[model samples]
Target: MTDGQLQQLVSQISLHDFKRPFRHRAYFNARLRTTGGRYQLESHNIDINPKMLTDFDEKTLVGVIKHELCHYHLHLTQRGYQHRDADFKRLLAQVGGSRYAPTPKKQTRLAYRYTYQCQRCGLVYHRKRRLDTQRYTCGRCRGPIKPV
Candidate 1:
């Protein structure tokens, strides 16, 4: 959805659920990596991860919006807005908002630290950390281990 649509949706959700008007901006933020949405304390603006809509459906989008709205309304009313606060928890539950934001898919690839091969069996293994090739042997054939 567009920024204008996001703003409208936030306003609608705020009025419908909180019985309060949302006067701040709501826009898609591509740089948001793990979080589904963020409510800025300084600007009172809400930044939603664009992938939330692209990767998920309307229901998920609504839930994320509700979650961010919880932070927005709570902060604006001078109540507990942080995730750990009771006010935030209670209001979030009352509004049926998502408890945690959905994590975005990681784009970067992982690095492999170690590679091992079985001398007799010719089996290979990839590991993040180095293992002692002298002590460890192949499980299938009891073969000697060597670095690949």
Candidate 2:
């Protein structure tokens, strides 16, 4: 969704769930890596990871928004806003917000192109490129190795 849509959603969620208005900005932040959303204490703005919408469902997106809203409301009211605080925990549970943000899945790539086995020790090694078996020996027992 666009930044304007995100702002509207956050505002709606805040009022509907928290019984308070979210007066600050809420926008997609591509730089957000690990966390699904962040509530800035200084600016009172909410930064949401755009990948959450692209990779997850609307339910997941709403959960993350609720989680950030918990922080926003609590902080604005001078209540416990940090995750470890009892007040934060209680309000988050009451609002049915997600306790933990979902981590993004990483793309996997094959790193090894070849495998070798030591003739004597049977130790195996994986390499991205071919190795000169004649010059190199097994690291464990100094035994000869052959490509497998």
Q: Choose the strongest candidate by lDDT.
A: 2
lDDT of 1 by residue, 92-141 (tens): 99999999777777777668878899999899988999999888999999
TM-score to native of every candidate shown: 0.71, 0.72
- In the range 61-102, model 2's lDDT, one tens digit per residue, is 999999999999999999999999999999989999999878
lDDT of each: 0.91, 0.92
Clashing pairs in 2: none
Count of backbone clashes, every candidate in sequence:
0, 0
> Which ranges of candidate 1 are over 4 A from the true structure?
108-148
Q: Which stretches of candidate 2 lie over 4 Å from their true place?
A: 107-148
Candidate 1 differs from the real structure by a C-alpha RMSD in angstroms, to one decimal, of 6.5
lDDT score for residue 128 of model 1: 95
